[model samples]
Target: MKTALCIGGTRFVGRHTVEELLAHDYDVTTFTRGIHDDPFADRAGVSHIPGDRTDRDALESAAAEVAPSVVIDFCAYHPREVKTATEVFVDARYVYVSSGSAYARPDVPMRENGTPIHDCTPEQATDDSAESYGPRKAEGDRAVAVAAVEGVEAMAVRPMLVYGPHDYTERFAYWVGRVAEYDRVLVPGDGGSLLHRSYVEDVARALRIVAEEGEPGEAYNVADRNAFSLSESLELVADALDTEVDVVGASERELAAVGLEPADFPLYTPRPMLVSTEKLASLGWESTPKADAVAATATAHVENGRDGAENGPARKDEEKVLEAMEETSA
Candidate 1:
């Protein structure tokens, strides 16, 4: 069995990717801070190593001990983080999780070869400050791209807005939940703005594929054909819930006036965030349709009450921190 090391495998896309890898029968080892609880804790074929990736000695020790064939780094945000990981896992293949924000002001249909938002060079370390999420990740991408040792290669996987079960952010869930309640939905920019909607599970699967089959030194955009308007997404949610909903057109500034930013902008914003998945598609990957994916998400939302809609805290990170604290105490 092939051995794979996963960082940040206890939540979100990382968690899903771990499950998918296990389903494919790969021997998996996960590294985390022992923060979150995983349902797979009792699974027969899995192993978890508790440590902080930011701690160079701890992470390096884990890497030297595990020596996995592939290291799927889902948690790294800074270029220094990548450097720390690479120093410890020099012999393994690397697959870094990046964001589509790395694209430099992308055109409507963003391609992998699109204008880069930042130069991909190791000399330029990514700034990990919260505001520079995109640029930092891009720098990490470059760091990994240039630092791989002989017989070891690295690839980067960038994904856009990901929505699905257990999504604590509730960004997508907020829109879906509002529509389900039969409320007047706000549509940003006449619902003509297009953004790539990727189901989290599909995005997870794409990450696994890129780790296993993607070309080294290249970045792959893991998005589906479901480029949609904010209006279309809301309609899908309403249809799934069999609810009558109203959508109001609002500009970015208008949404901002209501305490909503483009980041918080609901399903109908018209800014195009298209990405060409030809690179990933060439690897024979398939994704669920947008409507079906959202329907599934709606079902999960109702069942699990993820996001603040269910009366949880506003930010997913807050909930995660609480969960982590609980785990630490336990």
Candidate 2:
């Protein structure tokens, strides 16, 4: 059996990727801070090492003790985090879960070679702002890409706006919940913009496949092959719930007046975040059906009691915006 060490394997993508690994019969060890409870702690084939990735000594000690054949990281945000990890696990094949935001100002379907990447050192930012987050992540991926070690392979798997069950972000769930709660919905910008999102389980599977079959020094974008427009996305969510809601298009200024920023809402981008998955498909990886993923998310919203129509504190603001939008259009 192949020995796998998963850094930060107790959370959303980490947990799901571990499950996928276990299903493949890989001998797995999970590394976490012992803060969040691990749902799979009792699974017979799994083991755990308690430590913080930010703590170089703690992570180095774990890496030496585990001596895994493969290392998949889930919580490497800073380049320092991945740089230390690469140094410690120099002999292991590495797979880092990077984000699509690493692409610099992508306006079309972002291919592995498609866009100008955010080639920045994290130290340049000095602060973790919205602008810095992508560059920081890009630096982390670059850390693995430029490793000087011989006979070692590392690849970056970039996923765009991952969503599914246990999504604490509540961005996508907010939309599903909105459809369940109200008859009319305030959609921004006529719903013509494209949003690329990957289901958690699908991304998890892609990580496993890439780890097994991906080429070293390569990066793959793990996302749905087809890009869904905002309108198509909302329709899929509503169809999964078997309901129809009126969609009112609102301008950003109008939404801002009611305290709803487009950035605050889920999948609210004006630019197309399309990604070409040709590299991933070339590896013979298959993702779950988009409809199945959508249905599962819609079902999760209802079953998890997260299907509230309003965005908690922003509920009144949303309603006010809707009422004012109606008044203006009438």
Candidate 3:
């Protein structure tokens, strides 16, 4: 059986990637800090190596032990981390998880080759602020290129906002919960805001495919085959919940009346953010249908009792905005 080593596979995408590898008949071993619960602790074909990825000695030890044919890295946030992993796993096919944020500009359909990557300053590379996230990911992509040039089979997979089961981010769950509990939902902007997102399983599969079939030194974008508007997404959640909801579109002034900005809402962007998935699709990959993905997410949200209260404006604040709108309409 093909041996695969996953760096950081105990949570979120990492968790799903391990399952994907197992489904494909690979002997999987995950390397993590052991802080989070291990979902694969008793799985038949899965194992774990407790270590800090930032420590080169720990990574080297894992590399020496597994000698993995493929290494999917989910925890490499900085460029330095990518550089070290590429050097240590130089012989294996290494796939680095990058982000759509790495693209400098918000193009309508951010193509892998057409878009310019965000430049990382020396300060940005070391900083851990939210503002520096994209630049840091971009620099990590560059590091992969450097390794590929040295004959390392290194590639990058840039996934846009990922949502699905086991999503700790809970950004999407906020909408799922609102749709489930409320009769009317408050949507920011004109409700046509487009934010491309990928299903977690699709992203996990992309990591495996890119590691196995992608061209060295190239970056591939992964997102839902179809991008949805904010209003449409809420509608999808409602459909998944088997109910109907009044999606109330809120203007900037209306939201500000309740002391909330459009930015305050999770997944609300003034400009449309999209990425082209043709590059990844060309490798014989396909994305889950948006409806099916949403259904799965909604089901998981209910099962986990994730209200996503911290992800967006509180329900009480939303009610204030709704009351103001009602008075204006009346």
Q: What is the lDDT of residue 213 in candidate 3?
A: 98
Question: Which digits, one per residue and each the tens of the lDDT, describe model 3 over residues 287-329?
Answer: 9998999999998998899878799999999999999888988
Please name the candidate that would achieve the greatest lDDT relative to the true structure.
Answer: 3
- Candidate with maximal TM-score: 3
* Per-residue alpha-carbon lDDT of candidate 1 for residues 1-330, written as tens digits (9 for 90 to 100): 888899888888887888888988888889998778876698877798988888988877777778788899988988888766766777777888888878877677778776666654443354445557777887877766776533447888888878788777777777766676535655545666677878888888888888788887788888776576677777888887778777655555554443554554443333577888877888988889878887888878867765345432233433343344346569
Tell me which residue pairs clash in candidate 1: 192-270, 193-270, 193-271, 230-267, 230-268
Clashes of each: 5, 1, 0
The C-alpha RMSD in Å for every predicted model, in order, reads 9.1, 2.3, 0.8
Candidate 3 lDDT score relative to the true structure:
0.94
Q: Rank order by lDDT, top first?
A: 3, 2, 1
Give me the overall lDDT of model 1: 0.74
Cα-based lDDT for every prediction: 0.74, 0.81, 0.94
lDDT of 2: 0.81
Better of 1 and 2 by TM-score: 2
Model 2 ranges off by over 4 Å: 148-150, 253-261, 307-313, 328-330
Better of 2 and 3 by lDDT: 3
By TM-score, how accurate is candidate 2? 0.91
